[model samples]
Target: TGESDATVTNVIVASHYMNYGGYDNLKIASSTPYPAIGIKMGVCEGDSTLISILNKGMDAISQKEKSDIMNKWITVQYEHGVDMKKVSRIAIISASVVLFIFGSFYYWNRKLKKEVSRRKEAEDQLRNSFDEITEQKKIIEHKSEEVMDSIKYAKRLQEAILPPTSLIDEKIEKNFVLYLPKDIVAGDFYWMESTVCKESNNELNFIAAADCTGHGVPGAMVSVVCSNALNQAVLQHKLCEPGEILDKTTDLVVERFERSKEEVKDGMDIGMVSIEKISDTQSKIKFAGAHNNLWVISERDDIGATSNKYELESVSKSLFEIKANKQPVGKYEMRKPFVTTELLLEKGERLYLYSDGYADQFGGENGKKFKTKNFKNLILNSIDKDLNAQKEVLLTNFNDWKGSYEQLDDVCVIGIEI
Candidate 1:
């Protein structure tokens, strides 16, 4: 709060944020409270290797080394949070067991082919082996149950972090949030909040669809950090500008991740928006994205984008595209400020913010991915439907396309009718 409120832009904040290659505005106020003193990396007590690594890292650092490392990066090893070696060992064991189990099926097939005269005895032996198979099945089922229970708990925690459904319903008159996770949990998340603009005394609705790096557990962790950053920018700093909010979020997220000892390239791609009613005929839409784009759909009865104002029908769908800055919300070798786009929408037009999961789904007869082109066509086919119905249509289409294949990633899409 103080950082945003400072009249003098030149100020001191802890230098941890600088490690992620952002927050250049704030300098360190003092040296005693290093980045480690304020931020923390949680680890399991049973993990001795990680604890030893931390001890060695701290002890190895000298004043000169601290200056060198502090000037460049903050350090905390992420392996303390999750042990990859144990997971890999478990995976290898599971694969070996599966192969052994399936090999029995092959063995039974060969015995049936080679020993028809002894079929009765072979059948007896196979039936007895089936008991063992059933035992393995029971064990697998028990383990699966435990895994699912933990995932369900994780799902609840993830849901609690999201904005309340009541708040969304109260603020947004016409909208639908389509969220689907490949697993019980997801990396894709949507953020929505409504605030009354003090200067204009108009209600402004803020919304974003973000796709965090990775999926499942890793992605979920990053989403929590990114989501908190968004909340801090909007709720704490009282920021409303789409570009400004994104910029602030970038700095915060970058700084947050920089506290790690490893080079954490993890980040999120977001399509953020601010919608305000300009008049009955028009509304102002401000959008900014980090490697994601906004789609504005226009109907003939409502408002349509004229070629004079916007490049009309650039997409095969019934919408015009507002391209995002071709950069992510984290450090890049080539840095560029996030670009913002503005549009005036008629009362009938609709806006869309989405993560890539929908388009990147692997499905269809050829077992191919449902690429962006097909996704656009599906949107165009369902153009006349209400936002809620559109969601159902999309899901149905996705299911039809997927057939027997599993979902590839977490999907999140948000639509609002202006």
Candidate 2:
């Protein structure tokens, strides 16, 4: 290593210099002939006082104290050999701990990813189901609209079949018809036909309030059949008597039903009247009913004096009821000839012909049927009013009694003032 140099010089340094490494190749030529220098203290150039004090303090220290201090600072303690086994064990344990932590993190991250994928799949399935439901709902709504359109067209046809108000007004001078159907089409109908009597040559107006078997479409169909039967009895057969007309009507209805293979038992409940004007203040009335009645209110005080031919139910001095046969106009085991009741009504008499819908309605304080007794009272109380005003009274009382309940059936009420 000294081949590059021409001359080699040796220098003596502090004893602490031997504590460091990289000096093994240097040789101590003569430790006893080494040059020596005295230890000196340093201070600022202008601070001679601090230098003097430090000199005094150093001089005051004993030689044994100085030697002990120097030995304490310079001494070094060193272990003889390294423990390779303990170092190797600590390194293995640390590596194992770090590996375990990273492995647990990786396992949990994979599990979380799988769970997220499963939730996304379920959400997609639910969205598809919702879309299918929405499409089905649209189809159902379209079908419902078609059905409602058909029903509305049927309603118009039904209305066209009913007798107009002007026709009724022309037939009866002072009359009011309160016709209310539970649905758009009704089972209840009011019919009137004017015909000339063959014997007396006087005009006879046949008026009726009839309730068919059911309500809505089925009832409306049956009503058409029954109404046609009445028309045949009056116009085709030339029947003027109420009882004879009903008899012919029942026969025609039964015959029509017999034509059907299935045993058809549908029929109507009717209150029919044939009115003929006799003089300026007198009129002749023939009444016949099938499960319906006629109410006559008069202030004349001789309610049953003129009509002794048939039994009369005298509810009050002014109100009188002519009861119908208990059986319906349709096929029945105990069917008999419908009785005709004849009455001569004078001026200021009120006549009422109605279906059972008014009295059969369900509502009130206890949600009970508006019984016949209450119906009689209502008509009797409103007898003083004109036919139109009395119609309003009847409608008001009916709605009040019905309250929030649904209407039970079709209502047809005809009030006539003579």
Candidate 3:
């Protein structure tokens, strides 16, 4: 009866904590109990394990003793046992949660650092690419400018080979040269000279116009070669017949270009006319043309006694039937011979020889060609006008017909009066 109660679970054990005085008070309550057997005893109070045992034990006790012992003992025991374990588990879970939060923050911080470094690398690569593109653009611009300057200088060199105004003036006595270049250089060239044939000692005067293959720089280069050949033929080689001169000139061009292994098919379509003034009444004439013609105008006297309107007479005819040598001055061998023809000129006669430039010029509002027939008409139309006036009118008509169209080819015209 004097033994002390110890705690059975980790909960407040009131029996263990109470002073000796508390037990004495509990003794007085127990001593003064009523007459009933349950009333005579104090209510049972214990730790969770003890309360459960007491609850089971109370079933064996009388019904009169059940209520007081079960309510008090069971509640106290549950609080000390299951409830205390719940508190301990809660504390452990809260510590785990804190650790999880710190771990997430650490992982995200490392991810952010990696992303920042990648962004910096990408930006640097982009900047380098942009700088390279800018430098390349500058290089391309410089190269383009150099190419344009080279083309401009090439144009100047090609022009130097053309016959100057002073040179043409010396040969024709009085003449007008309408020279137009298609590009910066010309593929058409004209030449003239006054001399006596050495073999016959006859006063000989001649003019020639030529159209080379192609039209721009390549054509201009060919023209230079051809021009040198013609100059050598007349001045150095002293060739007599026009056909013989052309044949010899072809041989020279072939020899000059042989090293390049290039085909010598390149040559000029040329027209030449020779005038030998014998007397005031008449003159001996010899003309040759390759795919072109010569026109002459003469005044005819009517001896009839009736008054009549005077008509300007056209004496233009082919110096020879226009034909090719059946071969070009090239690697290909030619067995055929070039043809040449001669004609006589009467007094007060004017003749014209020209390149295809004038007839082939594309003009008019519709950009149509000034055809050969129209060219013939134009020549006949100006037969009555003075030579200078005729040239002026011809230029005026061309400009008027051309309108806004650019000249498609170089134009050259040569007229001679005997």
Candidate 2, residue 132: Cα displacement in angstroms equals: 3.2
Backbone Cα, N, C clashes tallied per candidate = 3, 0, 1
Q: What is the lDDT of candidate 2?
A: 0.82
Query: Where does candidate 3 clash, by residue pair?
Result: 48-77
Rank by TM-score, highest first. 2, 1, 3
Q: What is the lDDT of residue 168 in candidate 1?
A: 80
- Model 1 segments more than 4 A misplaced: 1-147, 299-317
Candidate 1 residues 166-265, lDDT tens each? 7787777788888988777788998987777878999999989999998887788888899999989899989888888888888998898899998887
Winner by TM-score: 2
lDDT scores of the candidates, listed in order: 0.79, 0.82, 0.64
Q: Where does the lowest 10-residue lDDT sum fall in candidate 3?
A: 24-33
Alpha-carbon runs more than 4 Å astray in model 3: 1-159, 193-195, 280-283, 299-335
Residue lDDT tens for model 3, 1-418: 9674432322123323333225323211112233423322345565677767766776688865666654555223222224557877997898789888888788887888888888888888988988988898899889978866776786677666666667766554545555566776667777666567876798676677777777777777888888788778777888767777677777777777775765556767677776666777666766666555555554444221122222434543222123334454333464344555665666556777677777777777678999977876787777667677888877888788777887777667776666
Error of 3 at 104 (Å): 27
Q: For candidate 3, give the lDDT.
A: 0.64
Tens-place lDDT per residue, model 2, 40-60, is: 557899898998898899889
Clashing pairs in 2: none
